[model samples]
Target: MTRSVYVTGIGRGDGRQVVELGMMELLTRQVDRVGLYRPLVHDTPDRIFELLRGRYRLTQDPATYFGMGYEEAAALQAEQGQDALTARLVEGYLRVAESYDTVLVLGSDFAATNLPAELGVNARLANECGASVLPVIGGRDQNAESVVAEVRNAHHAYTNLGCDVIAMVANRVDPDQLDSAADQLRRSLDVPVYVLPDEPALSAPTVRQIVQTLGAEVLLGDDAGLARDALDFVFGGAMLPTFLPALTPGCVVVTPGDRADLIIGALAAHSAGAPPIAGVLLTLGEKPGQDILRLADRLAPGTPVVAVPTGSFLTATELFGLDGKLGAGTPRKAETALGLFETGVDTTELTERLSVARSARVTPMMFEHALLERARTNKRRIVLPEGGEERILRAAEVLLRRGVCELTLLGEEDAVRKKAGDLGIGLDDPALDIVDPHTSPLRDRFAALYAKLRAHKGVSYELAYDVVADVSYFGTLMVQEGLADGMVSGAVHSTAATIRPAFEIIKTRPGAAIVSSVFFMCLADRVLVYGDCAVNPDPDAEQLADIAIQAAGTAARFDVQPRVAMLSYSTGTSGSGADVDKVRAATELVRQRRPDLLVEGPIQYDAAVSPVVAAAKLPGSAVAGRATVLVFPDLNTGNNTYKAVQRSAGAVAVGPVLQGLRKPVNDLSRGALVQDIVNTVAITAIQAQGDLR
Candidate 1:
């Protein structure tokens, strides 16, 4: 049975799409494939559906995404009956449910529809589909008493009609009334009642929404400003000095177009970052002169500036009435909605209540999402030595924006800041630490420590001083000295140059002979581990067995269970060679030492992973056809095979993760992308969890 959760609303203005988006997020985190269905919708295009489809990678047919248009449903109800409407909805839902593990059903909006008893209609459809209903009650502009009353009514109405009401949400409540409403609703309802405080940023209109609303002319700025949320409007009626103090971040400027002084002042304030204004609005259908317009562009190159034909009064009235919805354009709002939902609600508890079965196989997305969640749970500081690189800066922006971890970038401070500025990346905030290795206060201390550690080799502080100036060396010292939890580098350096410092200083972990590396080859449906790819060139039986054991532990760390495959040219003694003999010895050693592991050796590639080949060759062997960890005999074979599979299958390979290291220090490819950096950083953070001092 496909477990489905139906999010229905009572009347409109409830902002129920947040619940739908939140539910999609919750479901996708637990499963690989999730389908979306709307029982009823308007004839116009659905912005929420578009957002969900693009964001969640949903590929279900767009036609099957909805049961019927509102006009068609209402007409059917008037002509045939309510049973006809329910049956058609059930048919549409079953089609979608057959394709995915879970289905998220969106109930109809209460907008100019002719259906009888709109709320009751939603209840009947939920019953027909056998889905648990989560009704969202609108609390905006309502007192605590009314909010509590409506919560009780929505819960009773759904349960009384035989619909399984699993949870209730009271959204858009006034900030002052939030505590009282939450208290009253929680006491009144048996299920969970998550309350979301009213956010002006969600209701406040963006520059793009303003353009679409007033049909305004674009005088300046770009999409960045267009998507910016205008939280408040600052009417430019005062002089430059007095008005600059009134400016606020994410506020829109409203003034007469002839008032070039106000416009220039607001733009200057925004450029200074005292508070970055969202955009400027010109009223009375007047635009600034060409010279002033050029100045405006120079001040803040993409800050939105729009002009309207109406006066400021009427524009403000419409702007205040505008309430933004989650869509493809407003990703920031999606982030806001998700943050609010996550902060206020206990999703784990709610998920247990819903009781969707977890998938046995781990998808790449699930693994990646799990890594991020783990990192965020206990955020550790990660240092990027390639701070001057563009990809690192871009990844830093994403990491900080998602609140993933704390970062301290190592380089020449001025050069790093300039490169980040040139790429249009923001690194000026205090949360980020941009350090110049040459002038760092910790440089002397690190040099002394390095010299002390290498005194047996006749190394002095002078030699250690020069080496500490290198970014990779400095970053490694930071990790060793407890300044940073972990380090991710190699965007422009070699792999040996990246990890060589750790081998010298941090050393290997206890009870481990060699440091092995693994690449997480994320295929389309599942994640597989390919180990010893970049570290060992050639290994005897003992070293190969040790590598296999270390690689297995790394696989389990990332939640990919271990079923080891020692790859070679021969299969079950079919062929004999030195390489095959070595693999056979290593497989036997692993079985002898750790008998709990699933071991298969001298297995060809096809025999290892293909069911048909395994049945013909190694029948009924558990690890023959279903291997999660593939261990190559040598670096020559492992490196080439991993690259070939990556390019041919179009898989994302996150790797060269060094196992058996005392401290966590990972290397990146010289050509890593922004997302690759993010993933590597996340992996590094997880690796540092046990060693946090």
Candidate 2:
């Protein structure tokens, strides 16, 4: 039977969607082909279903997952009986389950339907589908004791109905009460319980949501502007001075459309970014005249300005009632929700409890998710040298949003701030620090340290001062001085410039012969390691063996079991040449040094990766065709092969991750995308986790 999990809530406004989305994230991290099923939905399109399909790239037809609409479900229950309704729902669910390795079943929303005793109905569906129940309890307006009591009652209710209650989640608890509620539940409950505090971002209405709810016209703004979350509602009824003082960051200003002065002032404020408003909402169906609108456009281009037919009072009422939904349209909300869920829940233990077998094949998405989760376990501070670059700033926003690491961006504070403002990235976050390498007080100290380290080269204090002012050298010095755990740079610089400072300051590890690199080639089914792809040009036999050892160690650290394959043009003794001889020598050295490692050499690419080729040429060899780590004899072969496979096979090549450094310092391709920068930062953080220094 296919394993299934039912995420249900005891009452409305529990914010159970967070739990449901988090569960899907967890399932996808372990297995591919995970399915989603909604036992009952309202008449409209399911927002959460669309989100899952888009986010996870699910190809399954949406119709297959919906058991039935709530109206039909209610009619079936009322007319035929409860048993008849459940049987039909189970039949629909089973169809979805059979096609997937595991299925996540979303239970009915209690507020949507007029069906009575919704909890009992959900329990019956879970029991009939043979699914484990993960119940959610709302702690929005309740005290710590009430939250605890509610969880206890919910656990018993599900168990009494013969539903296998795997765990319980209490969401939207007050931050102050989170600890108390969690401790009480831990002592009282037999099973595990997770608590998530209320997040304002998840609840704040977006400009798009307001426009949709009010039936307003978008006279101005783009998709980016409409996506801004409205954290506050500022009514612009007073004069410019009073209204300007009341304006807050992420606020939506509501005023009569004829009030052109207030509109221009608000747009000017948003342009200056003193406190960026989410948008401006004009009431009474009035729009600013062409001249005023043209001026407003100059002040803040693409800033959202909408018009609604309703008056100011009615608009305020509607705005206050509207809340954001965690759906396909709101990606920022999804990130915030995932961050909250991952931080509060013990997902490792929860997954173990589910007893879902881990798939042997690791997809690209699965590998990326594992990197993030592992990095978060021991958060490290990483310095980015190219802080002024656009891609770096965007990647920093994503990293901070996901709670990935502490970042110190090296650039002039004023310039970086202006650029971030232009990109609409908030720079006031506590986890991020912007530094000017030239004017910082630490520059003198760093220069002194550098002079001492390079004293034998006859480098004077003045020369050292100039050298430390370079961003790459400054960031590398931070890592060497233990001020930062790792560093990721080279988005705008060459690989040589990024690591040359490391070569001078950090040096190699104790037992390492030379610093090498590897590219984690994320293919469709699994991830393979390709070494010396971005570092060495033409390493000797001894250096080749060392690279193999380092690559294997790197693979093992990331949970990819190491099976070393030394690639050459020849398969075993089929050919004779200097290249084959070099590979054969390296293979012998690896076996002699680390006898425990499974290694094969002088193997062609096809024989190394293809089972049929291995069966014909090198039968029964441990690492013949099952190689997870491929060590190239030279950089020319490694680099070209990785690029070919990446382009031809549609693989995601992450790295040129520098191995054997004393402290972690990785380089990004100058043409790296935003996601590539994010991945490199995460990899650097994870590498820092193992450093005892």
Candidate 3:
């Protein structure tokens, strides 16, 4: 049985981060699963949802799991009184508790000694969920009396409500006062008391962290200001074909001179449209050409454009390294990135760290409509290739009703509808589109193109048609032609089979030498990206260089700065071989082609990942031991190696996240699990939103 815990106390002054971190720690202790429920969040403008989405990367919205909107939930909290709120909260908690072995109940910020009416609600909820409550106290000022009062209140609430009190955590305590606070608090409370230290500014989120983790140099803008409050970084344009993902919007590093076309293109593609520019650092210290100046004037007129003396745009990257402004700013994404990197935290670790705990005894409920509504509001789009398989249909139906995406299933409308109905999957809405490959306008176009291209190859028209009719081909075509923003296939195909069509029909973006695959490995503390795993069998030096470049770019797309490490069996010049030679050559190529990229190669895996190993193997290398992107020499090494790490090292593999396509299109293994499908869709949606440039 999976050990399960419930997390409450979200939205109570750092309560969210506290509960999230606590749950993550618990998960590392071999817990089977950890779940969080926000039963009674205040009615705000999707702040809770945004928090969940941005901080935790949760795909399911609050409404879906709780059967209440943020507004409705807030209203219920006020009108229904504590008893009613507790009942509703408990009902939801129990619904999620059935799947786990043990559930950890998170407490709210309201005092345990609140009015009897309010106490009853919390107590009742805990009892119904069959969860033992763990009071997580967020110590804002660390007052002894206040702390004691909070604990006593919690104890009374739990006892009166007929629930067990397992433990109590005093979160975010000042280091100097931690001992006294813990001692005083423990003496007053019956539960075990744990004091969590106040994290340093280094522990806080900042842009410097993001930049260093990605191995990207700060091109322009005030690093201090950017470190604080920069939300999304937008990277796009014709230059996007050559643009690195390392420059997200809050940092707004411009391609020197009059590359306003790039900026305009990126702005047009942004989901929220373009955010106000933080600042623009002109690359190469060049003035905008007349056309570019005109475009910039029309688009972002007052945005400051800082100039550096670097002659070439690429040379401007050196400014980031020279700035020496790593630790400045509040709400700094860079700082967050650095803190995350320093602790070696990957995406999985971060996600786990942010998960909340729930109770095991509660009966889990499926609030399909709520989930669907949230997905719809988020404008998520999930693709289902036409075959009308029962599993696919059922999955699609559940996802659709829950508002996961604008569902696109490939097949004749009649057949798809029949299959859906037969499978008990409802699809009576206009949002669902059914396309028959044989009759699709795009398919016909592909057929014509293929026939013309292969006419002299002795391939019959029928054969050409058959090849173009493959779902993978059609799906790639959808992404290429903008019919769909992204695709998820591989349920009935091999990786090669899924990818071959993309390679042939979709083609690489101009200047991209090879298409590569990256695996977003989610570990306990951080996300480590492995690349060239699914594509590029035995990449040459040039190909390896492109893989490194593309892999780094991909990291940036996901808000991760690329710290590229060109991996080989040897460290530095320790070994001599075609493989090592290729790595060394590729490393140089990356330095030459993208001088801004922090890349080093001819390094062993251990040296690339472990600081100790890196120090011993290659003392002076910048990327040694700190590399975020690992480029393998061949498929044999990249594929087998990453799989071995996934199984043995216990990393949650998130992708074969395909990169370098004109749009966001990825293939799945034929036997992809449901969760795999869900994650792929999420990743695709994110990519689609950013693919506008």
Candidate 4:
């Protein structure tokens, strides 16, 4: 039977997309095939459905998911009565449900639709579709008591109309009143209730939204800059001296294009990091001269500069009316929405209630989601050495917003703050700490500690003092000294620069013979662990065995069942060579040492992963075709293979996550994306949790 979850709001402005997107994420995590159905949609493109399709990578055709447009729905309900309308919607939903393990049903939006009593209609549709209802109530303007009453009323109305109300949500509630609202709902309602505090990021429109809504020409900014949420609108009227003080972070400055002084002044302020504006909007179809525009580009390279034909009054009218939407183009907003939903809702309980069967395969997104959820369970402090990098700053914002872990970004406090401000990252959160290793008092202490620890090898404290000032050494020392639980770096530095300090200070774990690394190669269907990919150019038989053991342990820790495969050029001793001999020897060593581990050796990649090849090459071997942990003979092989799979197969390679470290110190590629940093940070936090325990 296909389990259906219908996320419907009482009215518009409920921000129910958060609930809808959150449910989609949870569903994807649980099932391999999930479908989405919208009973009624506006004439315009369904933004929420598009977002789900893109974000979840749904393969269903758009036409199959939408039952009918609002006009068609209203016309049908009027002409043939509500029963015919309900039957048609149920027919569409059943078609979608037939092919999917689960279907997410979106109820009608009460936005200018002539449908009578939308709540009752939604209830009827949900009841007819056999979807458990997850009702969303708008609490934007409601007091705590009123919000509680609204939830009660919504839930009662749904139940009265023969809908199975599985849960209730009070969305966009005031942050300060969340606890009050939640408490009142708990006492007043019988079903589970979740309250999401109003997130300004979700509500604020992006520069792209502004461009599209006003049909403005993009005169500047990159896609990333345009994705920035405009938090406040600043109308440019005052002089530079007076207007500068009025500017706030993430504000979009609107003014006549002839006001070159204000435009340049705002861009200069943004460049200097006093306040980062989303973009500068030129009004009345007038723009500055080429010289001024050139200077503005230099002032803020990626800041959006757009021009509109309308005057300031009309532009402001459209800007004020524009609200942020979740769609194909707005990924940051999706992240923010998911973060808000995950934090506010009791997903475990909801999952149990939904009774979604778990999928056997773990996709890349599922792996990343698991990492975050595991990290958030017991939060740890992770130190990032590359604090000034834009990617690092953006990833930090995601980490903080998701409440994954506390972070200490190692850099000059002012410079870090300025950079974060320039990127529109909110640095005011207490979970974030900025440190300047050169000036911090801990620098001296760390230097002294380093000198003492390395006194046998080195002769001078002066050398250690200078070395500890570097962010990598500072972060590694923080991990060693227990100031931070883990460290993730190398975004803007070499891997050697990031991990060399770890070797010097943290050293290997107690039982480990050598430090090795594994890349969580996330393929389309499952996540496979590839060992010794980024470290150890070559290893002897003993070192190879140790790497295998460590890699297996790492795999087990991350919930990948350890069916060890010692990968080689040969399969099951079909060929003989120095490389195959080393792998065969390592396989024997692993079986002898672990005794309980499922180990197979001298296996080719195809034989290790493909059951068909395994049957022909190495039949009846427990670890041949079902291997989760693949240990390569050397770094030359492991590195090339992982890279080949990553590029050719479109796999998401998540690491070079160092194993056998005393404390968690993971290194990233210099070209790592913001999401890569986030995953590595989460991995480090989870490792820190194990270390702490």
lDDT values of the candidates?
0.85, 0.91, 0.58, 0.90
Question: For all the candidates, what are their Cα RMSDs to the real structure?
Answer: 3.9, 2.6, 24.8, 2.0
Q: Put down candidate 3 lDDT per residue, 1-693, tens digits, no spaces.
A: 323344443224434344444343334333334445545444433343344334333434345345343455456667876556666666766665565444444444353323335445545666666555555555656665666566566566666667665555566566677777777866776556566655533233234444444343443334333343323333333455555434443344445455765655443322122223344444454665566545554543333344444554344344333322222133222223222322222324323433434332211111111222233445645566735765566556445433456778887766665444322233555667878887877766777776665677776667877877777777766766667777877777687877776776677778788778898876655567899888778888998898889888888766456889888888887899887898899999999999888888888889988999888888877888888788888999999998898889877777788888767677776666655665666666766666421
lDDT of 3 at 207: 42
**TM-score attained by model 2:** 0.93
The C-alpha stretches of model 3 lying farther than 4 A from their native spots are: 1-382, 394-404, 412-415, 439-446, 449-467
The best candidate in terms of TM-score: 4
Q: Is candidate 2 or candidate 3 better by TM-score?
A: 2
Task: Rank candidates by TM-score, best first.
Answer: 4, 2, 1, 3
Model 1: residues with Cα > 4 Å off, grouped in runs: 43-45, 141-146, 174-180, 219-225, 255-268, 284-299, 306-311, 376-379, 384-451, 454-475, 489-501, 534-543, 576-593, 634-636, 670-675, 691-693
Residue pairs in candidate 1 whose N, alpha carbon or C atoms collide under 3 angstroms: none
Segments in model 4 whose C-alpha atoms lie over 4 Å from true places: 284-286
Q: After superposition, how far is residue 90 of candidate 4 from its true place, in Å?
A: 1.5
What lDDT is reached at residue 114 by model 4? 97
Model 2, span 365-385: residue lDDT tens: 899989988888889999999
Q: Write the per-residue lDDT of candidate 1 for residues 1-693, one digit (tens) a residue.
A: 889899998898998878888888788889877888998888636788888888776777788888888899989999999988889989999999999888899998888888879999999988888899999988999998899999998889899999999889999999899999999887787899999888776787777988899899999977666777777889888888898889876788999999999998888777766567788999999999999999998987788889999998998888878777689787667766775677667888889988998887766667777777778778899999988887898788767755678899988876676555333345655558887889999999989998998899888999999888888889999999899999999999999999998888889888678888899998877888998899899988888998888888888888888999999988888989888999999999999988999989978888888889999999988888888899999999999999999999988899888887889999888888887888999999988887411
Model 4: per-residue Cα lDDT over 283-330, one tens digit each: 999988889989998888888999999998988888999888888888
